[model samples]
Target: MEIVIPEGSGPIAVHGFARPRPERAEELERLLLSFVAPTRAEPGAWQYQVHRDAADPTTLVFYELWRSRDDLRAHLAQPDLARFQRDRMHYLREDLEIHWLTPLTAEAP
Candidate 1:
């Protein structure tokens, strides 16, 4: 799908899902939670949050917004993210499913 950004310098929004191995739900949650503080502290990170489904604890979700796409790219290159990518197979049932969002509503002025 083609994602169009109305403004060239607009914040980038992202939504993603990660399914943990059934037995590793808590472990995965801890690992994911560890990224929150550091990620939120990053230069261009406007928001970085994680959530787990109450009905399906193994399903993890992330909602993030960055100053720009470049910031998001830099975030993906962080050491912790690289390590997570390398080691995710041990804890995840499948790879992360990420969806980049295109804003359709104007920011409140």
Candidate 2:
């Protein structure tokens, strides 16, 4: 699932929440971080970051960049991705919300 986006386009932002389970928070963070290194190494990945809400620890945010939407879709399809999703879903309190983002300006290089 390689997403094809125009060059210099803005990043895609996916934000969502997981269950408010303190016990699984650390494990979730560990699992999420485990994918960080590999995701950054991906060809289309420009940036990939996970953020925890200051007010609510259970709330997680994902900020990702890709050459194109196809790239992001491909990343989601990775083999180990299922495990990641499963882990999060296991403790998630609510459904995930995903959003796609595009740059507002196309500045010249």
Best by TM-score: 1
After superposition, candidate 2 runs with Cα above 4 Å error: 1-11, 105-109
Go through the candidates in order and give each one's C-alpha lDDT.
Answer: 0.79, 0.65
Which residue pairs overlap in candidate 2's backbone?
2-70, 3-69, 3-70, 3-71, 19-92, 19-93
User: Which regions of candidate 1 are displaced past 4 Å?
Assistant: 1-9, 105-109
TM-score for each of the candidates? 0.81, 0.72
Expressed as tens digits, the lDDT of each residue in 4-56 for candidate 1 is 33345677788888898888888899999999999998888888889887887
Worst 10 residues of 2 by lDDT: 1-10
TM-score, structure 2 vs. true: 0.72
